[model samples]
Target: MKKMSLLKVDKLTVQFGGIKALTAIDFEMEEKEILAIIGPNGAGKTTLFNCVSGVYHPTSGEILFDGESLLGLSPEPVATQVIPRDRHAEFFCSLGMIAGTAERIAVNLRLFQRTEVSELFEPFGKGQKGSSAMPHKRNPILAENITGLARTVRSYVSPALEDMVLWHERDISHSSVERMIAPDATSLCEFLLYRLAKVIAGVEVDEARIRANMEITQGLVFSEAVLLALVRSGQPRQKAYEAVQRCAMAARSGQGTFFDLLSRDPLISELLPPRELDQLFDLNHHLRHVPTILDRVLHKE
Candidate 1:
């Protein structure tokens, strides 16, 4: 027996007027997995997606989905964007009811104020009002403007409805809109899943990057440990507080470390030596009762 990937794209290529969009691209995705395609602008991210989703037949190469070739099949059938009014709205509302009812019973109380809850059902609003001084203003900061643009590009439904009323040049009336949606939606869907796959896998965090971020935090990372140690020692609370503050300032200025500042302070040096102070910052410190916690959680007494 052999394991196989759910989707494999091999040597996919696309060209427009000698401008090579994708050249010899190869990638694969396994079952129950997500993938992401990322690249800089003009790097064929969308073009490759179009090829995979059946929108643009690759100038060359093979696309295998579930071990079957998807080439030549219309991408339109593969992706359908809809705002199914009755069915979709009913389904979403029903889901909300189920979740809402469960939550209400769990809390044994009515949650949220009446006015606050009404906002979700309000009619969708659009546009921004410009200043009264400018009557010709047409501000474009509309709610869901991006969403509307996305819908227009990949999920528009109005053209099909409007076409039903068309008489002559009826074919041209709908053909233009269909052409855009068919390829655009298909490519967008492909790009979406490709991008999602990378997220699911968790982009590899370069150890170098993590180390760089850690450096920026400076010695402030040890603040809690220092604060707790000050509380634990027999020193009066206010005096210990001021000493730690001075140490932090010196550390931030790159003058000395937290321990160095503490060492110079005659009071702390006499009371707490270096060896004991080291214990406070040790990384291995844990919650002390791991087994007891796990036993309660897993029900394995």
Candidate 2:
């Protein structure tokens, strides 16, 4: 009989600057499989363990635990220290709830909300029977189905939480709940997780659509940055807020682009010249903190 995989790693890679700490490592382990990584010093064994323990983020790859992803999840290494063994079911229940949220996010992206200019996303395969539905005749069947399964998994959380409230004599009420929910929730959750992973893997981003949709709001998205810049230039808070809001409202009302309207406004013109105002709307203003955020996440902060 073919053994079920308890742990699966595919195309795992880790890089540090110009050095590759691990390069496309691949392996699988079955339940109770006694496998060892036999290697001398600096052979990436430590790097692999770091990846598993959430100390390091893999540069690229997949790591599945009982068909659910460990690497894709944000780490809570500290929880392992404090969580009692009995809370394993609760942990699984919480994981199910998280997976439900994740699955819905995936569904929304695949459904790819339509904007004035374009649909923002499409993650489904061509094989999906989108032809029969109203979504441009394309249905997000896979993502939607996974969402339903995720809700089923989330349903178990209530009972699992209640399972902790048995009588002081330790009656078997929780035991019976465990007997039924344990297998059902776990089996279903594992399947749900595996399917969610597949959905996320197949997701595709439409750069053109994304950029186009970003323009749908006519640069009003940068209003906050404009407001901040106005304040930094010594504009009073109420005055700056009103100026930015007026410019935003003008943009929404089909006035010329937000920048043009702001430039024409006498007060805004004095506070923010074209060059300075232009800089405020640059997309990089929002992305400047990405590297720091990435570093924190990679370090499990």
Candidate 3:
């Protein structure tokens, strides 16, 4: 069987007014295959690359990336602006939950950096191997420390909230809790935030492992897209829902890939052909909308 091309550019042509930059360029690349194009000045190298990147549209022919057309994605330039910060009065009672987000992230890092699992991060300092006994081990001990500190900060939150419910304005219990927790939570939060910054700054990212982990779900992530597409194809909502659920269950039970099972289903095969089915299972398809979302966030419209 011939290997499928991850990227295919056929009969590509580009022109700027009457000057032709490129003509009749054709190429096919397999997944994980690297190909370098070398050329001197005015050889249309950048133009060809730009065409594939969706920066410049081809005057003729087609460009397909991972089975999806890379056409009509040229983005408009978004203006840049500064975000100003403001000082606000404290609601120290709720500080636990806010600082708890850091705790949540630290907990994740603590788990994900385990040896056999994603194993994608090591938030250790320079010359630190993260382990004293195992030379190859790099544990998230810093994140673990941060987690303990965040827990201490949160321990004071209950007292603070209970103090809010007290009847007297000058309750001795409330005043005592304030005098103790005020400095403790504030100082601990400041220290945790600083240590978290340091740990993150010293983090070592394993990009290859991250990419391999992206496929750990066995294409199950695209099931929602398939479900919606089936509903759009005139199938009843419950019918589509049940069909998709069955396929997903089969995939989990080690039958086959999610896409293979969905495409082989009689009802889904008739509604969504192989081409549309291939498009639905793409990760980059979801990522292509990120720029537009960032535009909205920046413009705040």
Candidate 4:
């Protein structure tokens, strides 16, 4: 038995002024079969789909379904037969803006997390504390507030996804959902950006605390430097890695400082002397290229 195509488009053409959006496009779909049309931007892909789906009338075409001409038919049937999908460009665009704002806020929040309030530009108000019972407490309340609000903004995406499953020709299911989520999501994102800007502008960075925290690891953070130094000093990579790993683990478990362990190790001492080891642990050695990286990022050169 021979089966006939369920839907067919033959010699479809579309033109807008002098622009021929689609030309001589032809395709067919059988029952329970899927078809995909792919093309670069502005290459008439949307035009062909629109014409076949009844969103746009083609200049010359024959669209048939079940052996009947579908040309010049009302759009309501076509729209119902084919699924109606919302592009939601505006909602997605707002989401992107919100994500970017949230990312910036997260960076600022992390800065506050790593710093002490005493080192802030302006410390907490007189007698202000995080807990009612503890008078010496200080919290990053502003950053926490932004984090909470960002969660609310992110949650709106769920309802947006739910809105995609509407009944034929579109229904009122997504209407109320959009009405609630769109304004709330956009406004919340704007509020977060504004509040984040204010927080960042007023927050003071504690350089002293930053420096102290950087040294809290007792030089274990420089294990990579030691490994590279060993490699550069003609030690086999596996041997150097095992040597650095032992030191790092010992330092992490409060056994000894990384510098002391490496300096005492016979293998490491043979290649890198005390002076060379000292040079490797220097913070400036790691941050020496920061200025160049900053210039490239900020100056875009």
Residue clash pairs of candidate 4? 121-204
Q: Weakest 10 consecutive residues, lDDT, candidate 4?
A: 115-124
lDDT (tens digit, per residue) of candidate 2 on 120-222: 4346565655656455654556667777777877787887777665455356677777687778877877787777777667665667877777888888888
Off by over 4 Å in 3: 1-90, 165-168, 289-301
- In model 1, pairs of residues that clash are 34-197, 35-194, 35-197, 35-198, 36-194, 36-195, 36-198
Which parts of model 1 are misplaced by more than 4 Å?
1-200, 216-218, 284-301
**Number of the top-ranking candidate, with TM-score as the measure:** 2
Per-model TM-score versus the true fold: 0.31, 0.65, 0.61, 0.61
Q: Model 3 compared with the native: what TM-score?
A: 0.61
Lowest lDDT 10-residue stretch of candidate 1: 113-122
Candidate 3 lDDT over residue span 205-272, tens digit each: 77778667867767888988999999999999999999999999999999998888998999999999
- In order of TM-score, best first, we have 2, 3, 4, 1
Per-residue C-alpha lDDT of model 1 across residues 1-301, encoded as one tens digit per residue:
7767799999988989888999999999997789988889999999998787666888889999989999977433322342222333343344334433333332221111122221111121245354367754432222223223334333344444454443442335555655765555445444434433332243222345444554565646666676667778877778887877888888889887776777788877777778866765553343456778888888965
Error of 2 at 268 (Å): 1.4
Residue 251 lDDT (model 4): 88
> What's the true lDDT of residue 110 in model 2?
57
